[model samples]
Target: MSILLVDSYDSFTYNLRELIERATGCAVFTVHNDSYQLPAEQDNLDRLISSVDAIVVGPGPGNPEQSHDVGIIPHLYSKYTEIPILGICLGFQSLCLVNGCKIRLLHEPVHGQVSKISLQGESSLFAGIESGFDSVRYHSIYVSEITDNIVPLAYSEDGCLMAAQHVTYPHFGVQYHPESICSNMGAEMLSNFGELVQKTGQKRVADKHLLNVQPLILQFSSSKEFDFQFEKVSRKETLSVCEIGDDFLLLNSASVPGKWTIIGFPEPNTSQLITHSQSSGLSVGVWKGASEAVNQDLWPYVSRFMAERKFQPRIDDPELKDCPFMGGFIGFISYEESAPQDVEPITSSPIPDTKLCFTERFVATNENHTFVVSIRPNDDLWIADTTAKLNTLNPSVSASNIPAKIEMPDKQQYVESFNKCQEYLHSGDSYELCLTTQCKIHIDNTISPWEVYKSLVSNNPSPYSCYLDFGDAKLLSSSPERFLSWDDEHCQMRPIKGTVKKDSTMTYEKACKLLKIPKELGENLMIVDLIRHDLYQMLNKVEVTKLMSVEEYHTVYQLVSVIEGDLHGSNYSGIDLLKHSLPPGSMTGAPKKRSVELLHELEHQKPRGLYSGVCGFWSVNNRADWSVVIRSLFNYEDDLCSTASSRCFRCGAGGAITVLSTCEGEWDELVLKLNSVLKVFK
Candidate 1:
């Protein structure tokens, strides 16, 4: 189905287009608020309105009583009675004004805030959503009273009419933005509108063609040690590898050359994404990409191609099927969209505005069994190569020496940085700052990326550890913290806050003292709040599943918290969830934007690259899981190291800096976080 989205000059109109298209599987065409008036454009506007199945009047600034504020509403209401129309925010007030109702400025205006709503009764637009839904509001005016021609179906806590339908025509209007992240069940509510469009006999059916691809499956036994598997795989080729637990190893090496490229923007429309996958003729692949900043304009997106399927927002409950992890997209999106519109680039840095890679084959193993799926032939699969490669192992050179003395920020220099963070906190510029430093290690051809990954995992067996070998770039991560995860059913984010490394000099009780420290507790609370705010953007009611608690990792006893909420509706995808919670809070600090700005000014290092970001996968079924890129190492192809005297490797390490942070304490924390990887070199 096609939707005509009337843009009314709101900053969030584009966000609305993304939400509606993804939720309804409809083609949304947008036009400016004044497009109807220009003599040259009026003919085009009329033709577009006639062609579309539905018309959505988007939110905007200014008084709705003024004709110029929303001039398109009156024209559409008078001229088009057959098309389904839904209005939002300012458009809601316009709906009221046109239908002989009253609209007035609210005594207390709402801007970027969540409103608790109470539904009047059963309504088509709010079918699957709860009675008391939490929704986002960005308006100064509201529908104060409704006439007999309009029936109110929902109200805000203050008794203002929040939603209503025209008594005679199939028309609806809402005071809150269902397209917004703050609307907990916004996707579902928006999907209800799509159903209304279908009831109008306007559903567009897509043509289906059988997926053009061959399926390949291979399995490995989990009983084999990871070290053994690593050695065997390294001898063959570079592929993507994932550690699900001590038992499972998933590897993908189905290489289709010249298919990879760097992607910059997030495409949230499922229909367009499906078209991209179908056109490529590969039903499954993984896209590892990065964005300099996280905002509507630029987001990291993973297109998980599943058999070149049509847009399927919801699998009917009676016909529901469980889909195993099919390959898809995953990667990190920085806190900002790109460089600020006017800022200059950091000099001589090879890092581009974005970086990504796509892949289509994988081999998975667990304690009880091994599983493999690849697009390649049987002979090219890992099962055929493992035993032979194992027989040829060289034990003498398996353990390489520490290539060179590692260089890190000196204690004194880091202390100064810590003090500056405190000053920013005191100045009220930021609540917390995650100050980080880089450690460099120079190597030669003798260092094996696979061996390094095996060493890091053995030393620090983390729940979210992973390894990726992109030929020119290699990633070895031992991240314990889960950045976020979402299936069609639920959305979750777990942020790690406090840390205290294990020490023989101190008793376990003394070591646990870090959990009880006021500074640590405060830091945890601040991040928890930040996470809650981020969740509310795309969800309705975020629940703190777990509060401050101590969890033991391989190297540190850490304070962690879990916060989660239901996805707005099945219409929402894993990409939607990640976009709402990019640049994980624990790493970025509280009051996100201000803190990130401070880091840009205070930290002297280049853009964080993949460090402190996240890495994971978005499955073909729209389920996803990812890890914060902390306690991790990413190797970019450095011409200087590859062709010159020695090969240099870089890794980032740091901690959250708050007003309560001590210079010595933060430096100690930084050293402790890097210790697990550092030991590999030792």
Candidate 2:
């Protein structure tokens, strides 16, 4: 196969030429500028172009907007629809320009800089590479706006689009020079592109209208509709669904059967459930795996795994781009990831160490709109056909009338646990401790998990509420506390510490009572200080953006505080932040590490799986947001059993115990926090 290397004279052309030749195992045909040196004009140009199997557009000087500078790009782009074309820097910008995307001059042009580039979703362009890695960047112009035609593949730490691919063709572009000597694993990137060309030889470009399947989006009006669709779709054994805010995501695997894998703890690797399957669906695994490596935490593992697979139609919709709940891992991480070394080691837990799912059959729904995205290979038709089917799903069924009963530790037991926590606080062994206990509930199999989620959310209406149908178990949470939220520019953590049940008799009077309580303010301040310390460890400049603020939820009023900081450097990752500041301070207590240790001992060494953990999404943009796992219920049903009709369902509740905390008062707080969850049974 012949390869064409177009030079833009940026002093790296010759090196790029050699790299392409080596990667593709073909002799490079070099051309300076757009014009061919052949004696004839049109005929020679055609002959030179037709001789090549693939094209690599090398980085160069000047803005690609100047048509004269890179006029050949648009021409070659229009002509070479079949062959694979890789664009670098200037060529990358030109490709975006030709595709109706906007370009802008960077205020600080990247030159000889080594920056971390996070691969967005998955692409054949970056197969076998980690999610985020350092790459050599040298450019003045960048693609400012990505149109629908271009699917962004990667981004830099500063949120600049670094790599992208055509929506319909095998055309890929990178703002950084993969041919540069400084780029990490530079040669591997070029080789992957070459292999893609060889593998997809001589196929005619399909019509965009018939071939490109628009993303399927549907909306549900009421909880009844949401429940009906979930029950209908989840009848398929391999289907999954999740809820975020008012949105419900129904991910069906029936169209492309067996395109999923289920994994649990002790092993972090994916086991293929369907052999010889090429359809791209999702890899949903819980983070119960044990890892000695400090950096390979749950968030990092999910991000890396999601990046390794090449799912098709990897576009981030502008409307839901900021919705962190889309398509990455959505589940819980145990407190163990950050638990103190001295803590009684949690040997086993009823819930997985962590549960995260990587799905390309993404559905984002709310009260208003439902957006469904299927990235399965050659399944565009399936995606289009399913949209109407999803919308037309019957909502004839009403909420289940199954009887449910709640089981919790008796009042005496709770008082004893409360006194133990206060003793530690009074003795100065710990300043404050978040003592928690699990409440078990037995509901008839006929009771829909969806109904429970519906009842809790309707009553509580928390901002961070979510429902997860994790294959083995169902998780329903209405948590008001934010574990953390990170974008490319800043990192933020919001902790909810103080809680007071809403009093109908009083309005401002209730707010004043909660606001004036020294115990409440002290609890909030202690965690704030701990979180600030955590941020100081990983961030450059830490600040408490909001402090001791009262935020009212439907069931109760809470004292919340916000802490933010700039990421110290690009080297810090989501996993790093999670590792340093995990088991969120509000959940653990003042002096996070020691508090966790004391609680582990105090709670009978029982692991808090999915309880007091976190449930949220890690985005493809190298950003993530998670909610502290509280005010939640976890259900693990046994469908495989022949005679078993009952399932294990548990909900967790806790209160911060300080020296001034009364035993009866702490018990009251725990019950108050659980009212929303318990009211579902009533």
Candidate 3:
């Protein structure tokens, strides 16, 4: 059945569309009262009014008389006599005028938050309404008395006509907007109208013209030979797909108008998969309708695409050596009646078809078991497409894979860097930078370089801290906060500054003083200013919603600040924010680009990999929430180590320093923050 939602303003029309869609689960069309264009052709309009199951005239900000000027009410009533029609606010006034009711202008029109309504009798529109209920009212003019064909169904406390129904016709009108949330039973009222349409079997205006076919399924698998060919092409072309989970993540980065859309599966019935847990991060998309093409064509292309890249393990880097392969897993419990005395087999498996392969190999181990798994691109990317084939095969026996462990550098360099930082602090080159400014420092000496490489994937990440091991110099940090996260519309940045010692005599005043240091304050203010400027470029009405505030957290106390604004007219993507505001303000200090340059000069290192980057999900709604990669550890396995003994961890920390900063104090701060994680290690 068709429903016409008439409005005089665009906002009203937009809202009506959403309300009607939600209420009826049916497509609805809108018409503007003042438009020179009518809905469809003139002949079509007559047929539409005759066949339409219902018509809903929406409320707007203007006077009800304006609706007559456009002849909207007259036009609707002239052709349709028996159809169920409901009017709201302005529409109600139009209904009253057409039915010969008196329209009286009030000194102050009731507008929002009026009073309760009292139902008079068994009315079609008020079928489910109880005697007394609160509802929003908005109008400058109201109907004073019932018209000839209209029968009053409800009234306001002051005798104002709140609702009236046609005595003989199926027409209904209300002086309040039942489409708004403020209305007591708005959805129920709309749903009642929908039910009437269904019961009457009213001829519906055809809408098949708007229907479109669903897209074909695209699948990937690991058993196809063509997958290897595709891998060769991707590798030769230097295509890069994100290696998330255990599969080689592949995307068409080179496609023109490059857009990667993921459609998730229908909601699963499993309670474990349905819950919101960090262990079971939400799935991206779901597959539907199995097909031969999905198995043969799509799977191979994915497998080949993943094979083209090589994984590079950074042996010298501590963060990589200890990085954990962070991804969610789902377990299934199957019980057989024949084995009633035995407990059902409970097995854990990664979410299907969500795996991505890194260009490297990592030693994977579950619990106490360990084994080396080569994560190189499968001969066929189709292998990654496990949802279809794997489910069809019998479940595997329960057994844990042994993780391989590799040797990494020892505590000698870390000890040396720590001692050097201490010496600098004593020399008085600078005063104490905040103690929380340390970055992750690598400590293990036996993890595979590739295992470290795999830990950079930013899925299912844990809070970690690490010290960057750059032979001659080191950069340390203990970050457990998100720098910035955004989807399409809204963007957020949680900048962490200021720090207090965990076991020190620091009071709130001392903590505030530490943050308020001229150098520290200046640096923080600069970051705020930079963030404001960045947001200004993307958002409208930019404002410092929340200025510098002290937010006490579990592990430490931080001086945090918030800056926000609406995404300006432009449709900004999550990747846009990531590229613009990365390596967090807390880590980079004020004058971001300059601080980074100084960091590069003062600290000897290249890219910090995932250690300093942001990690979070960018949802389809164009919204996202991510945390800065800090207070976390990455774990890699040693390939040479026996299955029983191969796992390591890497933690990091670092602080912003200005020329006024004392080397000795900076070193001490780094150590203090580094201890925040090392203590967890012990």
Candidate 4:
């Protein structure tokens, strides 16, 4: 059934929408209080109300007395009398005012964390609620008394009206904010209202409700190996297949399956497909896709296939080309694949003493630009369970779907941790500094590494460099500063050293003065010298392409200089060069090993991972292109917590610190760099 939500602000409306959708499993349409463009107006609100089963009024920061100006309650109640109407917070106050009740401003506002509420009766609004329910309070006024037609459902210990329902009309109101996380039984409360609306609308009458089934658990015996066998049958010849490691096979069908069909294929990759005749005790069944195709008629066929095979299916990646079996299909029998089986098991041995390695390879290069790629495998692997751990150590590289180990932290905890980090910086505990340098050379701005970034696209622009389009062998970037570039015979590296205000108020002379600071230029030149030395090891001759020079980029001006050299000998592979010179001198400070050592000691862990690590791709012809992956996010398969940004913030300060850097200045710089990355939220 269609549900209409009325609210003024976007955030409020979004929260309400999320709560209702989660509770009812129904599609909800938002009607902005200020949306005059909606076809339904005061004149025809009755007709519009007649079209829907229920109306939900959301909470917002506004005076309830101004209801006449907005004409929301009048429009809804006047139009539909028999329909279920749930008013939340401000909406609740308006119901009281319009129904001849009195609202008085409280001497003390109830912002949050008030006492428990006591219900007078088991009203339909509080049908499933326990005796004393806790709810988040955020109101400056309270209803003194209920109108004659309204029946009170719940109230605070002090008798402040918290919830009430109209005796005759299907109208309800709640003074507490139920859509917030702080509200007790928030989702259940909304679900209660949803059931009322669903019953009134008769949207799913006669349809058998699907029960939520528990996830299946497989037990393994002494033999680790298992497999399943099936027949492969298809209506069409050509098909798209995706193999996700040794786990599952994704087959795309060209035509929809009309009846149950057996799919036969090769034995499982890792284990033998056990036959159903074997007494190994295994079962398989299909489930309809729970995502976007939930209500689609085609899902049952897909669900049948899954039920028969006992395989969980994932939504197809939309970015990839569509295959034939996208809508739905039928598939074959299966057997459990045996786990690993070995006559002789290898003994556990101590991990060999080896240094964690960082490799930076040259992906693509031009006369004036070069793309350097680096990978920190662990950053993409480690998963944090708690918010506290995420706050203490910032991770550089991360993978998507990594389940957050910690429960969701409150907003106040986020604020406290953030402020504590700031306090530490202000207390001279650490410094904010980037070891950076750049080259002075002409470049094809269109083809420069910075120009091709994904974040630089017109739809979602970013403040940092990004990688945009990658087609076959060619790659594109939109970097503000030149990192490194090279050709077949020669290579060059340029690092950004200093940053100045972007506004016109900061003159070039002032920028130059700021650039000359020992802490700023000193670290920058050191990195430049390091890059020059790294290139010299692989080149026959090396020289400064251009000394320190100034370049204007997006939000700020930068000091950049160039160094170039010819490839030393034929023996040098791009991989060799990357192995020797990794993590570019610009991101890590001078004395590369020492800087990294200190960073590990001062920061959370080693292997900056993806944050400071690089991302891009290699080409078939060995002409590869990649970016530093700064201002980027990693999605993991396991990490599924609500506050993912806390982890993002922890890894954000890795690039700040130098011998000459001050804690306060370093904090400021870190905040500045973070702003460049965090502005995406805005």
In order, the Cα lDDT scores of the candidates are 0.60, 0.62, 0.45, 0.43
Off by over 4 Å in 1: 1-324, 330-349, 352-358, 374-401, 504-510, 568-571, 639-643
Model 3 TM-score?
A: 0.35
lDDT of 2 by residue, 253-358 (tens): 1111112211111112432111000112223322332223222334444444544532222344544443343334445665554462333322222234555554
Whole-model alpha-carbon lDDT for candidate 3:
0.45
Ranking of models by TM-score: 2, 1, 3, 4
Per-residue CA lDDT of candidate 4, range 1-682, in tens? 7677776431234446666777877766666566543344554444455456678887654456765334565556545677788888777877777688888765544543345777888776677779687776655567887779778888887778998888788889888767543358778878888888877755632212211112121211221111211111222211111111111211111111111111112212211221111122222222211112123222233223223332112323331111111111111111001111111211122111110101111111112221111111232221122112223333222121122222222334333334443332233222222321111111222222222122222222322233221111111222343344333355556667667656668777777788766556544554554565455444435566665666655555667777766654434433334434556556655334434433443332322323444332221122222234343332211122213232211123323344445544554555455444333331
> Which is the winner by TM-score between candidate 3 and candidate 4?
3
lDDT of 1 at 288: 29
lDDT of 3 by residue, 82-124 (tens): 7778888777777777788877665434533335788888876
Q: List runs of model 3 lying over 4 Å from the truth.
A: 1-479, 504-506, 636-648
